[model samples]
Target: MPIKQSGKRLRVPWRKKLDENGLPLTLPTYMAYCAVAGALRPWNRLGAKTIVTLVTTDDFYFPLFAEAARYFSSQIWHPQRYHGNVLQCSDKNFRHEAEALRDERAILFASPSYQIQEDDRLLSDAVVSLGPRSARHAEAALRRAGLPITNESVELLLTEPWSRLSRAFQDRRDALQAIQRLRSLPKAIPPAASEAESPPSTPDPTLSDMHGFGSSLIEWGYDLAKDIADYKAGIIPWRDVENGVLISGPPGVGKTMFARVLANTCKVPIIYGSASRWQEAGALDEHLKAMRASFDESREKAPSILFIDEIDVFGNRGETDRHSAYMRAVITALLQLLDGFERRKGVVVLGACNYPDLLDSAIKRPGRLDRHIAVPLPDAAARRSILKRHSGVTLCSADYEVFDMATEGMSGADIERLVRDARRAARRQSERLNSLHILDNLRPLVKLPSAYVHSLAVHEAGHALVSHEVGYANVADIKISRWRVEGEYRALGCVEYDVGADRPRTRTFFENAIAVCLAGIAAEIEVFGSFSQGAAGDDAADLNRATELATAMVGAFGMGHTLAVEKFSPNAFARMRSSNPELRREIHNVLETELERAKSIIRLQRAAHQALVTRLVDVDQISGAEVAEIIRNHRRPTVSLAKPERRAAR
Candidate 1:
């Protein structure tokens, strides 16, 4: 029967190369067989005046040689065969038979198992055999075949001696043709409009000239910049070199851009791909093609980096049969390629995702994803940096306070938008920009009411107070607005808290949890004598998170000293979002207990709370400076008598 032939295969065990019998069969194996067949072409085409023996000592290689001979005879040119012209001799008799045929012109293909010596009678016309081991074997074989070569060039010779030369010639010819075609092309038509008739001209010096990062929270972004710099310096040794990294953060946090910057800093060619592009059925296959193309492109330009943005879309944790099978195939192909890292040099893989937990476990394992970096919201320092970078304003003082209170929970993108809106407002106001214009533009940032603002303030302040008082969270800033602007989201208050550098540690402090959650509502009740829905969302989230943590501590972790019950249930958030009668009753019970505890704490600091609220209501927008002044003048020392003394700390 004719030898079956198709695409290339390799005997890579990891890739399921061999059959159940452990026989030699794979794309690489087939390709190698074809390679040998081509190598025998010179002799096959010469019409065989003398016997040329192709011998393989390794049993694994017998099938490969036989296939090669058969393929060559059927697919390529065939030579006249004498009685022993095309012989597959055993290793024991390979040397003796070759010596007997020394007088005749012939080709001998034998494994490295047969050593080559200068005095060996048949050395002149012998070509050494090679298995799927080292390229050096091919080099030695070529040398024995009277074509001395190096390992570097052996791949080309063994794979395609004539094809390589042909490819180079074709490339040169195509390049010349392209240049000639370009030269022959017609010139572009000039703009016929006169200067007066043309649209107003504006000089664009740089692509980024008009496209700045905008009023970003530069101070908050300082740490991010440092992290980026550290990344550039390769300071953070990736925990797993084999597995790619997962970068998760809020939207518009420059995740993709960060990948690009890292790639550029490393001076590596980026194979930038997106999961969105591969969402369709056959899209992943096309992506694989592009990936292969990128490798080729990288070969021409080494040190390649493949940046996959929104990687979760491709590697989502789901059954393999669900979604596109092509996607799974693509992932499998990528895994195969990744596993080939030992053979593939200078290729780095980077994957970015906002929902990293949604990624498949197989993709995230060591030697696959290995690294998971949480690019969280920008801190105060980072916010300031982002603002400085994006904002065009050059404040008189380096310690300007506009960003200190304006930005809290805002992401880098949010800060940038604030800057952009401010700039646009300034431009519309006709002429030189001032800080007031920016402030005015930022006034209606959150589209909320005064009642909401007051409620949020109380809520956020509550969080800050309890967090600080309980000694779990360090207070950074508390404001009832967008992190990028003061008096921003009137209904939405944000309290910036530093949970400290001790990570992989539980964040929720049980002592502070209930009080922190009830602070907003308490403040609202204190001022308005009634509660508003302003702090509803935040309260629910915080309460749910705290309760879940506490429950987990009691149940899953067995950390609770008293309640050692292991409560296993999927409805963790059932107590939070549910409005069912029984659930609401349970929630109220839970909340009231916490609220009473919070009330007791606040009662102890009633005077301080009253003074702070009064100051906030009067000021409308209070700086950290003003807060400090108020705290110094009105805050009492007795409220903190129960707490420990301050110590030297970061």
Candidate 2:
């Protein structure tokens, strides 16, 4: 058997290449199979005892390899029948199976990996590794096959593996039909450009449909969209255009949607990928392969936008120890791709994450992902636009205004869910969608409390009252609400005030601000007879601000009792008593004295405080004007008497 005279000639059809669909193979597919076939022939000629070929490819193309093994099994030399020789199994199961069947002659189809276990080498006489096929490989194969497709079509097919092109074509047809249905709807925005069209020269109006439209969150996106449009129209040089932008924001703030709409507006194709999806593609090597493939596909469709969502998952080294080495390698690969992106003109990389700070410093540097834009929560006007877009036609302008007021800090996704919930509520009640239905739906979704509304009212009222009394003068508004179920954190209420544009504030101003901060806690104690955890957030924030102010006054501003400039860390005051026991006692006395002053002021304005709380509890919100009116009506008069004469007589 070892001799060359042991005649065995495997006559596989070397020049014939067919894709999974039984059509003439594209250049990449032909090259990939040819590589596999070529690797197997050498082992056959050497009279190998066993052979296993590990082909690394897109998950969609795994079936094509199984088909090729079957079609060529008869012509290829194998100890087992051609049908039974080709084995497709998961990497984990392959290890166990390879150990049990070491003597069997088979070709195993497994994901690509750089690390081959010792057991695998012991089980097979020969192993061949196949990487993803590149565009050049496809071009060469097409030339050899004498196919009649243009270079552009070849590029398009490169966006996907050869097996997926036919499937993608069918999906495109379905998508077009769906677009037709959407366009027929009442007031529906314009449909997105088909894949064949060039990038648009104007911004898509539907961008406004995204949440946080008027805010800075999407401002950069709009700018990018305009630049893309300009670039496509030949109005600007490609060098002037940005190569990549990082969109950082909270979840459901429309970061992913904004990328999609921007690409749509620019009329360019988009390739959507995510770190989670890449991680799910098998082992570390497979994940890396998938990441490279994603970028490669995006490049194949040049001038396309590559959107990578949840990019924070590939955090910087030292961020997490669980997958340190693996994720570091992933980040390194991504950095390389981003840096090389400049060479591929018309290609832009848009990465999104909730934790931009977690990304490596290298990725955020000037050459790669330099344009970091924050997609903040929607403001009032943006919220209004979001509600109007999601709500039914029956919702008038006034309804939108009301919703905007109600959904003060909600994200776009929250507004959309609220509208859908409201519609469901109306349907359940067998009634037309009305204000009551919307409000009812909102209560559960927002986690609006039926009981603690009064406490929240008093809490916010205290801040407003204290702010006005301290001459803040511009108490913009006071708002109260219960916990929102969909919100990230529980918010009881807030008092918005403007301190005016005054620089180098005096000690008195700092004291006033501290009092305003503590007023909520003080009010809860005064009105409810005990404090609740609702003041925990306010207390921590106010204490920190107040301590910083006290530290600055003593250290930086030289407002201490000794008239000497002494500097110390802000937290040093808390432990000052242990070192300079007397000085620490004095510092403690200062804050105690301020608290007493605040309590005294509250006592004096008890009537005004009660009025404000009552109004707040009744309406859940009040304007600065209403607070001022209550304070004015309940002002205590200044009474002058012969105090000096009385004291002399005594």
Candidate 3:
């Protein structure tokens, strides 16, 4: 296959090579095969001309080479003829065996990376670097081979390579058991940590850990948890409790989380299933067998939760689509075992799907997955609650209440990501987790229109120009983006500060930080006679940051009216400042001082400011070095970068 990358056509040479008969079956096998094949093209010619030997860095590629040799065992080395020593790993133990084969006019794969001097003779034939083991190369091979991979499992296979992947699966051909293990895990945790001497296993997730769920759905889940508890305790028969529920929601609303939590609450095991799991087996009979095995496992593990994700992928039988015949057969088999002659006894069925409308009508009939609940994206209140739930001590209720207004239309997934990203940013900064980190780390949702995009350029250009004027920090770069936050699309701007490690966190240092933060609004006042809410509209915006810095300067650093360190708490500070006019005046004076300083700088450097803004309006991004150069030279930016429409908008 020819893949076009960066204007070049690259050929991907891949064949199944050898993933059969007790050999590991995985993507790595194919990737390893690709590297070897690409290194030695025209397989037969290489075998005929010289004694082909692959000298490797790691012995991990031994099986890979053996499989390749077995596949291309042709001519004097015909596939059926050259059996065992077609490819021998020339390791320390097998050195004699490999040399013996070498003498007999056979190919011997050597370990030149280990001891090049000892195996110097083997390297003369051809020394090729094994580097085609890239996920991109392997994925192309997988697609051509028609190997089925789940959307979720693809990340685990590709992102976490070698150790985790090889441990999970060795090859894809005849890897039914490996596929089965991956299919059951709703969240695929890379299994590499188990062998690395980690801490003791923690307890499972319970009901309390789950949040942002609809009241009815959560209440139903809890009651079911209790009933399952009773059923397992022998206080009631399995038929007394509702047998199943169908939880439908958009992706990342935690559909599978419900089952895991409920199982934890009731102290029963949970087994995961999905249409893809059954469909992993290509043939109809094998698909049926896999489906039956999942059901049978649930039946034997009585009082267990059987959670089937992406249930809608089974598709509907009524529609006369091309795939109807096979699906109808699978659905019929599923329906029979779901409530068939052999009762499921104490199993609780929970079916999860992104689109409930796509599910088979029979799957949700009474006595099956009957109860249906729809989980929608969290609104303002729910988003606030979700933020608090995920943040732990990183943020408080008052902090969340402020953010609640800011994160109006975010989903449960988005909120979790917000907290996770904040933690990562905080770790990188070597600081304690703070609400500002969470707020600042939010990703841009969408690109903007022409009008707001121009304004963002002006706002960011101001910060970049003013930060350079201030000696506390230097502007690394400035960018404006069309940010789609909530349902609304608006322009947002950012200025990265390069604060040197040599700078001390003294009162002057913080005061400089405050001035840099205030530069945005100051520049706006200078250029447009007024600034937009882009400065201080939300709790996490520039105005808020400036205020926080000034507040910390006064109270935390003992720089203003009170020369006492008031340990910072965002909520407490907000409340204290609101109540105490004296403290408020102190913060206001500090802000006003920085504002006037920035405006004065803007007035003097108006040409540089306008030049940078014009360039930014054109390019949407500018480097700090170039920005400084522009300011230094006071040169007009080239008018070529902006579109005609953007120039008109400006």
Candidate 4:
């Protein structure tokens, strides 16, 4: 048979290099293969006289480098002469061999730790540097090689002598022996206490010790705390414990603080990792390595809490195309660590993210981060508690309530900032921190643009009027405060209402709610010549809610044009719109009808609306009772005078 040539050279981008199972290839192996293929190229564009390359890799991955060189030579280089072409030499004789090679393809793989003596030939244009493998690199390598080594495995490989021996020898018997030795290690003994020693007097704060959590949340925290206590007391096995929790909410809702408090309550040490810290390490590969190192550290300190902050960095895929592949691979590595081969017993992984919707579903699946706890923005009572906790001694119960009322729609962090600002103001004035100081500092922070105050008053007054007219008894309070702005949307004002317990709500109730929702926009248009985007956020939310309500009424509740209930998904309106176009039209029609009803109601209660708007603009806020009183006082005349003669005849 004639000698067969390998034909054109095969090249892979460093980022796209993968193993058979589609995971990222280890950095050393990837570098070695790329170097070998480059050296074997028919044309040496880099001005190299010889087709030989020197590659430096980590000591631990030296074997993988050799394996990669051989595999690439067979698959890419000339198959018949690959045996003679590929060479793995130590640094001891690398200098002489590299200088002597001429018109021959060769690859010299050496450990990065090896210090090669200065040689002219060794300092050639074909020197490739593959630095030492990191925890991330090892993970990528093991995954590419179809081995089941993870961060936990790395921890065991480092800590357990038998496990290390097993990995070194690649034998299960050695691994079993290592496990036996780990079990046989001697336990430590505590020193005897003196007679004067006494037990601690104070009660330790556990999950139950945490404040600001709701009754249900407190119960949940108590259960977790109890579980940890029981586990420590040897009353329960580690397997019976929940593995992890996912805390999600808006920023400054104390998600991070909650994690710290939970760890303290559980009496376990916490390992903190932030996504930005990992990204700061530079390349995606380095970021993965850092992330894996964090997990490994948590595993090493077993019976600990691992808190990964701002985890939404590994969000759902397909959001971007620029670095989609790189990001997806990173997420894959994270998923592997989260629900990998190892079953972590004592370690509890807690992740906190503001954008939970953006996170990958795989991360939230069972056996990984299964428990989801929402840390909501503090309510009035919670806000009061938070203010009292953060405020100086100058603030009393009355000041707390006033601060709480003023901080409506503000997060716990926002309140903390306000109190901090107040303290600074008091210190600057050399006086006690009082309500006046707080109010003065808070006014500037919560002040709205002068032009928008009237518009906001009109908007909130409209919602209050419509809600009251519709007999929605849960209406609590309405305010025109510029406390916080969410994303790109500015909050001019808001109307607070309670739905009054969970129950099967009717279509009439939904329609009434939709009317109240549109009342803000309607009121703005009625008062101002034209409505502004101040209600844009509310407009979007109301439209979505109306569409959902209309869809449910037609498809699920059978309360539409035809009383025929149909089984459909929640998003069926968009998917089945072409076949049943009326579904969308009816939804729009419902919203339009509600809008017109709101306009008519505002028109009928025009005097009352004006009174409410005036009070809101002047006073900045009004209680639900004040709103009802104004409406009651400005009631429109029910008896019309258009047919007075007919009434006299009767």
Candidate 5:
């Protein structure tokens, strides 16, 4: 049957808007739909009228035609195939068919490319027009009912179109596309088992030239001379000769600089790269290939160091080892290659990571990173030396008394930062190179050192006295103010007590342990009638540690002896991490018990406590001689009642 239009006599329904690629050429489609719809509205006055239509082409107008049909619900114009509405041969056939239907008051909406003679065509008032074509007349033939379009409006519609999906939906689609792309790549090949060998160090293991490198490692109390001496004598254990050495430590301990020193000492070139860079840009395989190439390139220069910085992330993320498959494969390949190279001829592999705990076991086994040496924060003497090196000033013998006490508990990096800040201040103030600049730089407005020193001494002294009296820890020399170590604080005072060889397990001993930990605070409270914030950080740390051990004894270690409950080692720190509700109560109760016990003990030993505080405050910096004098003058033996033990603490 011939195509039918609405009873209102509108132009043909536009159904062909999409081009070959499924994109819409919207301008012509809009014009066709608008003209046909507008013309057919007169038919809708009676009721909804149906239209029949056909579209021959699928370029520029396809989407618009479909959209209009859906919007108008034109039932009569059910164009199942492309040729129903448009007869492509000539405009005359199309116009004659339209005239044949003119008596029925139906309009035929044909493509704009078709032409009809005026006699055959309906009068302008009888037929509804979609709109004029914006582009070539070839595109103007297509029309739809109930719309009109100008050139600018058509261009605007064609230029800017809308997508059905939302932004979030688009992202999900993109991710799916990427995943599909990844699945298409070939599987990576695994390396053979026999390719593992250690890299070779230089003939002169200790390169004395390190003295001139001007790096922070040398000045930060790294003990270069000692490391060099040990290496020269072969006293230092060479770990992971096959894979590489993995150095682990917390941040700001100079790990990177230390790695550089090791490379220079062994006379090797440093090849630095981070394992994380590979995870981005879908470039893991490429990164592995580059790593292998790096080994080959550096081998020619023998004794070069392949430093894989942050190797923990390089491990396979989801394999049996919990690392990525590619990462594990790369690590395996690296280890095998390292093992295969007979003599590094001068190549060494060194790896650095702050998180050694997260590393794969394979990396730390005999063939990989075998030696684990802890690079701790600096001690007091090291801190003093570090200050001298960075500040470019030496402490006088007179100031050593004060200088040594001021730097306790400090790290190497801390010392360097302090020195740098001191120098900057000097430069700012236009002062000559002097020690006062350093003092001014390091001195906080709170003056924590002196107050902290006195408090620590008294605190430590309380621990000694209480431990001796209660028969727990042995009393050490009870040095009033020794500040030669890293992070030294001038204390009100601290007493040195031997924590004993065995980990105390008995209830009384545990109580004593609490007492000993609380002794410093007890001493502070006794002398000052209040505690200083100087002890706040240390007290919290010590309290938490002691509480953990105590809780473990009660809950997990089966030391409670009364509870008789199933022993389970609940990690206090981990529990805290998980935000367990009971932790606050349990920890608080334990601290309170210990604090009350400590207060009572100090009250009983009130006289001796007073004498110790008086002497400590008078001297500001007490020596062994002064401690002994105070001990004699007070008629109390300097030695604790209990004999001291010689065990080292963990």
Candidate 6:
């Protein structure tokens, strides 16, 4: 049938064929149908029990094409013969529903390659695979329907996936547009299993050179490396070697890096795998197949490490939901593999994830990913070592003192980025790497380290000092940095302080927060004689934040003069602040009162604040212990603070 488009009549052959066969296919199956047509194009016919195995660039295509082959076969020549009852040979129930493939007539086999049989003997003739060409035919059919896509895209399409492409087509999306979207989707199929093993880290900085994996983690890594060597040398039995380990931590803490380091230390190859990778292979069955293949591959490459980066994704059977049965099966299958993994000689398994709590209990049981080690954010000493290695420069004691302050609470990965950014910035200036570069990179705005260092110190110090004076927990310390860790947010400085976690957040609690938020500008005004506009930039600005908090207190908490309720959230304030002039006035009054309150504290703690500014300017960072010591040295005269009245808060 002819269909009229924008100007001309168009005949889409694939559409005509689907109409003729009463076939319905989503985009994936349609692509699969195209692959089948391409596979059968060379052959005059698909001979009986035609056992052929071919590889696709991405495993995602196999199952979908298998279904497509069934559909296309059903609609083609000898359609009756193709019925399950008559032929009854399929990996699937190929031609029909469950009952259709009766036990009596069924013949099933799997082959790694194509073969067609004549007489009693099987004959084989290899043909070009059902790959790019088939996809090209599918594109041609779409082009016939007045939709043309690139050959390169078709080739790339054959190489990878379209979970997104298929879903996009669910709402009558154009076939060309759907396939083209794959150009931007994050690899629908990750690299092959072997490619999954990151190419060996170069000698420049193998994981061995890296620091910040806690001593326990470092000890386990070396022990495992030694065990692998001893096992290979016949000095120890497989049982004597640690069966497996599960390294857990937050992201950017270098859980995966530890595995690579272990492999390097062991002098063995490492193969990385994860449940998510297997899932990308296609459906449940294909996922299992890919997973099993990874195990086999690890065994093939003995004395190897199989790192499962997302071991937590394999949720055990007990945690089943309607949608989780597939994952349940995955978890069950993984458990079976991990159980058997212990017996695989010369092979070790390691699992990593941000949330180990979400992992199957069985996976972390006695013989599986058992030896759990947490990779915490590096400590001050570890950060120093990491910075020294990554900064690629010499540092004096003073530089390190400042760096220790800057790098507090940073993960190994964060340190890595800081060093990288610092180097890049210094490189652009054609200067040798220095503390300035390192500090600047740590906080993106540390560019004017000499000029702005004291101000950022003053700002963050204000937060900490007020956090202290506001009857919150004593601040531990604060840091400023130039080095930027890749995954960490780009920033100049952050205050490391905490009130008691279990402390109740009453009206006083919020009021205290408002004071801390405003303290930076207040401190600036008290000492520097004026506040810089830097006190208010971005939504995180001290002034902006104080305003948001004050609005919440006045309008939502009903802590102000009036008891009228109003919507309260950070950005939700502008309307209420605008419409209710009384609310606006009360908010302003609260901010003013808090500013005055913070200034008074700053005034009393002038000696301490000045000392803090001097210390911060000298090092560009300081720890809570230091902050505490400084504040204690310049203690304020005893005075009573106004008690906050009880008020309901949002």
lDDT of 1 by residue, 469-523 (tens): 5554445555544233434432344565665576333313443555676666666
Clashes found in each candidate (C-alpha, N, C closer than 3 A)? 37, 3, 13, 2, 91, 18
Query: Per-model C-alpha lDDT, please?
Result: 0.50, 0.64, 0.68, 0.65, 0.52, 0.67
lDDT of 6 at 40: 55
Displacement of residue 608 (Cα, Å) in model 3 is 51
Q: Which structure is stronger by TM-score: 3 or 4?
A: 4
Which candidate would rank higher by lDDT, 2 or 3? 3
Query: Candidate 2's residue-wise lDDT over 1-650, tens digit each?
Result: 57543213434333544232233333334555555665565554323445575655432365566555554443444433345556654544655465437645567765644356676677656667554444555555555555544654444434443454333333225423432343354432112213112246644544665657445645666776788788888999877888788888887788877887888766788999999999899998999899889888888987789999998888887766777888788888888888763365778889999999888888889967898888888887776667666664345655544555467667899887887788665533324456677666653345456668777777777777777776676687788754454644556577888876763466665666667767777777777776676554542555555655665665556555756654556556455435665455555565666655556566677888888877877776678787788878985543321011112234
Estimate the TM-score of every prediction: 0.49, 0.53, 0.40, 0.50, 0.51, 0.45
Backbone clashes in model 2, listed as residue pairs: 27-138, 28-138, 303-346
- Segments in model 2 whose C-alpha atoms lie over 4 Å from true places: 1-205, 281-286, 318-323, 341-344, 379-387, 393-411, 414-459, 469-473, 481-491, 500-502, 505-510, 522-533, 537-590, 603-620, 625-650
lDDT of 4: 0.65
Q: How would you encode candidate 3's per-residue C-alpha lDDT over 261-373 as one tens digit per residue?
A: 88888788888888898799779999999888888898888778898888899888997989899999998988887898888888888898988998888999998888899
Query: Compared with the true structure, what per-residue lDDT tens digits does model 5 show for residues 92-179?
Result: 3645455435533233444546554464343322433443222332134223211343543233323222221111112234423432
- Candidate 2 lands at a TM-score of 0.53
Model 5, residue 525: what's the lDDT? Answer: 80
lDDT of each residue in 468-574, candidate 6, tens digit only: 88776768767765444444444466786676788675668777888888888888888788898866766877788888888887788777787877665666688
